[model samples]
Target: MSGPVTLPAILARRAAATPHAEALVIDGVRVDYRTLHERVQSAAARMVAAGVQHGEHVGVLMGNSVDWVVLFYAAASIGAVTVPVNTRFKLDELNYCLKQGDVRVLFYVDTFLNIDYTQLLRDVEPAFDAALPGEVLPLLRRAVIVGDVAGHDARAIPAGVERFDALPDTPEWRAEAAARAQRVSPEDILLIQYTSGTTSFPKGVLLRHRNMLMNAAASALRIGVQPDDRYFSVRPFFHVAGTTMSLLVALVTGACLLSVPSFDVANVLTMLDEERCTLTSGNDTIFLMMMGHPEFRRERIHLRGGWAAAGPEIMQKIHDVMGVKYMVGAYGQSEASPNVVLNDWRDPLELRVAGWAAPHPGLEIRTVSQETGEVQPANAPGEIQVRGWSVMKGYYNKPQETAKAFSDDGWLRTGDLGVIDADGRMRMLGRLKDVFRVGGENVAPAEVEETLFSHPAVQLAQVVGVPDARLGEVAAAFVVLRPGTQASSEELIAWCKSRCANFKVPRYLQLVLSFDEIGMTGSSKVQKNKLRDYAIREFGLA
Candidate 1:
């Protein structure tokens, strides 16, 4: 139970156990374990050939494809760490991650629409710009292009950029690479996942091979993944849920992974029916989209496994429609390997609750009142605290922020408001920081947002507390309607009044055509701070 469990070891074990099993299916291209192993080795060999050494950070900025997986394992095989950059990030944000990680090599797709790499690096730096055809990525000593860049000039290639497709396609190369990969150890740092800076600047979350292996084992236990299970992962692989649960869990269990590079409702529905995926999970918004899809039939979308952090109503809808055997509702942030709590899908009641903490084996959970600093009794709401092996090493390069997150005794302050029932089930009330005072009463925005989302015409809703003279603060709602849908502000206000307390109902309503300005983390959680700033600017609220 305590032996070294590194990424290379996991791949080697799977390859040895089920070499012929279909490991991945991307755009209908099936890659069996045997072939995957060979490719991983080849990729790793090529990295070594290009001078990638032990412990160097390699940045992977590619879409969800087979090559992405190959490059990831290749880096791991050579004792190099990988950083999966968010594809959705703007150029500046992407630049920050590359620099912070001190990436020595970068593997990226040729181009994504609206994201031109050639233009982005035009003014990057002299050393970075002057590097040979395979070396244009400044902080990045070497670069590999995954797809075709046929017409692009070699001199324009910056310094050290090379086409991955141009690598020598020889069996010897593959053999040598595979041999090198087998040497990686479990203690090596395999990944550096950057935090989704919702409240502050992003930080790299360093996860060692053992950290990933243990988390994957825990998740596999929690979700009960089978070898034959087909997982449809629409979430981007850079996020913890996608990397640990969607990708690693599927790989560890020898299940087939069907990745969707980006979430498109139509594409998801088609994939669900066509692939007959047995397990899938994402934010509540994803479940809502699937439920509201026109062709949504319980027999098709919900087959075996579904998990998310959602409200009670949505959980009921999933149960009623999908007939999912395990509709797990859980909560956790980026720091705790992102899978601290999960509800067993077998129990109907547990499915309705927030989630039960994962069997941490060595983790402790406690609830304490923020005001009195006293441990709360069972069923009493308070701030949740945890201490465990699963907690992050620390927020990269931010000791002050890391110190603030943990108590003197080492309990990680989760910043989540919850209650532990008599049976030890955790019910998430809301985020403590997100809670706002309205008329001197604390109001969790999630409560009002869920209520607003329950309305027939409401597609998405976000509630923010604004300054008010009489009540000290009042709720202001921003709503997005379904296509061709319309509802007056008065109607929405009245609906809120009928569903929740008078003070909880939003006094101001803003019907938006789209939520383009509202930035979302890689996992799809709304950036409420952005919305709050927009409200203050537009409405002139002090």
Candidate 2:
């Protein structure tokens, strides 16, 4: 069924069927399927001219933009792997992602946030010159900066990167890209999303074209997407939810996607009102932002359902307040191409928040003991194991970790604890590992603790998730400050924002005098549950 349903094929078929129909609207620019498909083809040809080979990783570092979508499909058109770099990544995080993904060609905004990405690279690797593909790093040969020549710093692009418009645009190049795009197969590896794990660094989840296409189709159908729906998207394109769910779903169903560079409450409300969008898909953070905004009550907008995982009360409030009856919740990780288990919009509100989700077609789920591989009885909680077509092949270049991720018979241990009833309805309990979700983004304790440990005044640090009213959960830190070093909680909290992603920054920090204040196991691992209890009492997080 997925043989010819590749990412490029989705766009091609959509363009053929609705050549003049609206395809994407972002940053005040509207593009139709015919024009969008043409630009994607042109960009693909540029990638070919730039020497991006099949299986080669192409890094995209930019905010949500029409160009970002163009570059993504362009890379897909030529069978080059598209590696979406997190725009929030600082120098260290960005450097690691580039190296880890082994990106050969990079496309980034010329000047963003007053700092040039290429200059940042040059600061780290002074030899980072890439006038052409494979120019500087071990695998990174070329850099393409997306910008208008008339823009500031256009003439001042740090050595070796070409302007976005400088790429070839002739009919000959377009034809070449068209021919090459035709050769891309559904089984080809299309995306490498770098997601952090409980371990220190992030791993590249290798998703084939079919894995993404089917996953998007299934999830959209499960959520009851209507063909005439206009989707409002605020999530970053780097995340699977943005591309696979928001962008691809619109294409799959002939829906129009209305996007913004980032979430602005005013802009979101404006889009919701102006576009009369039938649905809006993003994390809990977006829903919270919209509901909390001052103009929230003053606005009169009608829509269907899209927000998910907000517990029962909030879900009910959204249904009543937003007038979106079908908006529902969903669950899945990046390895499963994002969503294998999804909640039905038509189901009762209680069932949705209870995590009563139906697995996608061909997706198999089982609960098993984390210590022993024994399968648990119905409704018993342990680790949730999933396997099927949507599951990724493996982590790129990390065979050992990939092997450890699955069992001998090939069940992917999801590291999450959940219960499955006899009816096959699953209730997500919590994480078996210290990893937890904060505003829908995974926050591994180690990742947050590692950033805190870098502080000079911090002797030891442990992060645990605590209940919150707005965000479903937030990271709270228990810190053992150095005896002589005097540091305020505010200072340490501010320090964390610089080192880690904004979401991973601890919201509540407790300064303790000694080790006995924390519950530690005999082997010296901090008792994570006790920390959660302490957070509730000390910070009043609950």
Candidate 3:
């Protein structure tokens, strides 16, 4: 049956249809659909009592928990936009997002992952204790702490901050929340998802309720998700892969979501085996880490299927080594509500593992020449452009960027290079901006990384272009060897040089412990832009 277009309506429908079914599972704590619905209602009422209004942004700065889920849906129910703050952000980054996102109310934890969020907030606004709304963050008035704040002398709940458990949930506020939900339209902005700022400051991508709801349902349908399925996902909720693809997928399909506050490989492997999850999701880095972990046992894992945004080698590993036979590859950015292209689980294994897939239903995908404005034919590489139900409304508060993000004809410029086959399946080449020229030879970092990944000792490889005197730009790579295995710079470069073109081989290769030294997004993506800067400094090119 075609479900409701709005999140609140879908939650209500699921609650009514399967009141006793488990909807969320975290740290052995389970929340059923009915209870989840009630919690969201109470949270929505609290939002109303706190003076949150329709169309205003409510920032969520907590880890993945029942509180995060409740606050997210609560804001949505009241027609307020949820701006999920990156949990890894420092004081400056946090300040920028809160200010740029125009967050009027914020729901955060006092402490998470050993980071003092209360102190960070104080750093963002020095007078946070003095007033409800600080001078630094003019729009932010209401601050609610969600997680445990007791039993720690250093971590005291700040003054004037409301506790999540202390929020008023009266009948009058409930009525107002329900009335607000009724007024919410599918076209209303549901989230202002901030992009991972790899190159520059992150822009808030405006996504509507319809865009997210449709994408989630489509993803769940593609994976053949069942109500009894226990889907395990370590992808953080701050990202779209976690929100629309994981959480909303569970909500729409009545499946149970297995969530974690952080990525602990040993704990995740244990949970995946103990809980007997039917489905799971992650990118290349996550899958690699799991397989490389000593605790990973293929026989113990009973996954049926899940989606990934990975390369061909990693996809193959996820299928063969990990025993996720139905693992499908996907391609997307935050601009398209994150899942523009996805592989159907029913498709052939090779196609599913090919790191290329068909576009979502009703999503129009086309390839246009980056040099020229003309469209390209099938099998020709060009800029991937999309115009569809899943495309975001625009970048929030960035009129020039929003206007530049799309073509004059209204198609969203993905800034990714890809080729659409005759069968209409798209193979992503690489990011348009990431492609570099070495002595007039164009090099896509994916092409180089693919060669490096084939090496037996290499666990993960991230390649970026670095400035050079003669060639203008040359490839620089950071290699992460398997846990017990080791590969030297000269050795891996030789392996790549033997397989790839001369210019495509990394001119400078650095062996690293992990992407942590460089930095990775919550979704496990290596920030290429940051790596590039690091390389420039390391090689003294700066």
RMSD of each: 2.8, 10.2, 1.5
lDDT by residue for model 3 (1-542), tens: 36458888888899999999999998667899999999999999999999999999999998888788889999999999999999999988899999999999999888888888888888888756776787898888989888677434534566757777777899999999999988888999999999998778899999999999889999888888999999999988999988999999999899999989998999999999999999999888888889988888888899999988888888888888988878888899899988988998999988887766999879999999977889999898899999989999999889999999999999999999899999899989899888999999888899899889889899889999999999999999998899889778999989987887899999999998878878786667888888898999999998
| Candidate 2 local distance difference test against the native | 0.78
Query: What is the TM-score (0 to 1) of candidate 2?
Result: 0.80
Give lDDT: candidate 1, residue 1: 27
Per-residue lDDT value at 508 in model 1: 88
lDDT at 289 for candidate 3? 88
TM-scores of all predicted structures: 0.92, 0.80, 0.97
TM-score of 3: 0.97
Local accuracy of candidate 1 as per-residue lDDT tens digits, 70-110: 88888888889899888877767776887778888888875
- What local lDDT does model 2 show for residue 493? 95
Candidate number with the higher lDDT (1 or 3): 3
Candidate topping TM-score: 3
